[model samples]
Target: MAKIEPGNGLKSAESRKSLRGTTESLALTDGEGNLFGSDSELNVYTSERQTDKYGFIGGAQQYSEQSAENIPPEVLRQREAKWLDMLNNWDKWMAKRHKKMKLRCQKGIPPSLRGRAWLYLSGGKVKREQHKGKFEELDSQAGDPKWVDVIERDLHRQFPFHEMFVARGGHGQQDLYRVLKAYTLHRPEEGYCQAQAPIAAVLLMHMPAEDAFWGLVQICEKYLPGYYSAGLEAIQLDGEILFTLLKRVSPLAHRHLKKHKLDPILYMTEWFMCAFSRTLPWVSVLRVWDMFLCEGVKIIFRVGLVLLKCMLGSQDKLKTCQGQYETMELLKTIDTRYMQEGFLVREILELPVSERDIEKEHLASVRRWKETRGELHCKSLPRMHGAKAIMAAEPPSRQDLRQNPTIIVESPLATKSNGEDKERKNTKEQKNGKKNSSPTPVAAYLEPSEPSPLLKDAALLGSNQSLSSAEYDTYL
Candidate 1:
């Protein structure tokens, strides 16, 4: 993992000197005559300047070495061809061959095509078209001063080894700043969250500043609304839903976690919020993003289940952990070999769970949440600038909000008033007049349906299977 030097391929010293002079001229120097703005300003330089300074040569070489390795040239050409065809007639492809599109995504999108593919899948292109110059407008406007310092602190830490973001005032870091700052302005109530920095940085890797900004908007407002907000109520509710799913699908692991008092938020917050960017390997992270954009938030739950099955499915494996700290540590740094993107994704597709199942549980979880925490107060916006505008224009019904089937459904519980028919269940433990011995009544949620019959006999059975010899030998 050697650091790629700033100007590796420049053969002549004079040419390198000329490039350096151009970069220095384009850069905004500080009062002390230092190149680029002060750390607090998050000054952005031209991508041309960054390309010269950081040696981000074009095409596959621009990607990380690990990402570029082992990809075949023919495969690259084929993927690019498909991307071109889809881009030219997107509506036709989407309407006629959406299943084929999903299958291709599951195989993994080519790095070169990933940016365009993401825009198409997440509808960022349409968003970008709607708000033609919104990013530039937002970039020029002053963002909330409070968020500037926080955004600056996270810039360098995002992808220090990647050539695009390695330099102090590189294009990648600058675009990341613009996208985040625009988002803070777009939804002032949400402000800035540290989790969003990594997600935005990843987006900047694949697209230009404006495209990246719109993609970030789609992710925040559509893919996972209220996820990066101050209260983080949506993610909190999802954590509870994940726990509920675990109880039915992997009772033994669920009980073990309950016994040790391990909360899902402790480990799952990063996984769900960052979309596994910080947790999974680089290749796996890209693969997950491909499916995630096409399928929406359910991919997240499926991936979480796969990781849990790999880490905690076996009783013997759980027995080795001494305490909550040890279990958390193991989960955080689990063997990546077992969690290879292709195999884990296949397992996810095979799982019996569906969007319908997740929606039902989400509705049930929200009901329980209301009972215990009073009412949820989610912020609402008049209209999001891009892909989320459709959702913002027409307020969703109570059932639609609770179901939250697609990315179009932002702020599931965004409205102020709960319907008159909705009733909060009594969640308090019933007193049996025994000394703390009465069993608490768990919320009455439906039992998870049996997994696909093929999965029932497989080694990995819906997050609760005995460790196979191969898995144990490789991962344990």
Candidate 2:
């Protein structure tokens, strides 16, 4: 793992071998990091060029991308001003007018404010402050040998077309490494998940490393717990819940899937696990994430439902999807028409599924799983949906804090300086010839400490993480 490139270890080798012929041909870089050579039409490269504003190497020119007409300048200015005001009075709005906040999220957070807005919406802002310097510490330490190599292999694979990850070990890739490596250190119990790479890569594109690290943390631990864990238990559970919800969302699609014996995980894993980063177009991905950060997993459910319904809901549409292979093929090649950001968001908003509906289905899914497969080993209860409710949930208990203590290795030089200061103080006392009492010798300074002050007394940013539990009963 000394170098960040395609991994060569046993597992990575096995993985590459398994998918070698199935995937598009891969390309390599010369010693100077220029395009070595490639025969695949999909493999396009040039000698170190710049990326467009959206980060794509060739921009949208190759794709003939068509976007809706831009908003009038006056409208754009009004929207920006409104967003600024909301940011200024964020807490007040969340506490009282969160519905308006949700509406704004659906409309689209301004690109300039998107990163900060994401930090606030995902609770990463609060979590980052609560665990100040933790990312640096985790990144500073060497990762588990097993995870390091796996992570290294996947670094260039994420967003390879984007300029951020185009080079083998550019600053973007280095920061991506730091973020992913920090996660493996932060939660060795969970280790690394390949799916996390694209997710983290997208985050790094929008924010700095530390903020991106915390944003990744909040998504893993709070927004979508167990989705990226060792066994993927939560994602599996959600798959069942999604299938069940499909009956209500689009009975025709549900019946088609049932008849074909297609499992939800089959078509949904890449979409759900990576939050559609891989499946959706870049613009749609951003729009969906905007709603996702504001509304939580329910938004995920809505997007999935919309895709399923639009793809397979009608009798006429189902004509082409005659069998298992054809159906899966259609899902793989989703039309860009179904993916326009404005259209998709509007469909998602109009979808009848509510958060309560999702919760009820979740409970029912758990019951079904218990009846058949025995009990699940989900670590924590599902977190509350959306930003306002998350901000309103009770903070973790003191024991939870203790479990996540930060380990700070003291610098040898600093320790020596402290010892010298103590010695000087003792010498002064002895020279005074008054008491000659020696203070208790200091123990080793290398020890674990609390992550943060816990912010029990202070406001978490402008919002409150200490809102009464009664107000947020859904949170656990």
Q: Write the per-residue lDDT of candidate 2 for residues 94-189, one digit (tens) a residue.
A: 778899998988888766667767877887877776777788789889889888877787776777677667777778889889999999999888
Which candidate leads the pack in lDDT?
Answer: 2
lDDT (tens digit, per residue) of candidate 1 on 100-154: 8778888787665677678767766667766667888899998887887677767
Q: Could you list the CA RMSD of all candidates, in the order they appear? A: 24.6, 12.4
| Pairs in clash, predicted candidate 2 | none
After the best TM-score superposition of candidate 1, give how far the Cα of residue 37 lies from its true spot, in angstroms: 22
Give the winner by TM-score: 2
| Stretch of 10 with least lDDT, candidate 1 | 403-412
Q: What is candidate 2's CA lDDT for residue 114?
A: 74
Question: Could you tell me the TM-score of candidate 2?
Answer: 0.74
Model 2 scores worst on lDDT over the 10 consecutive residues at 1-10
Off by over 4 Å in 1: 1-71, 379-476
Clashes of 1: 0
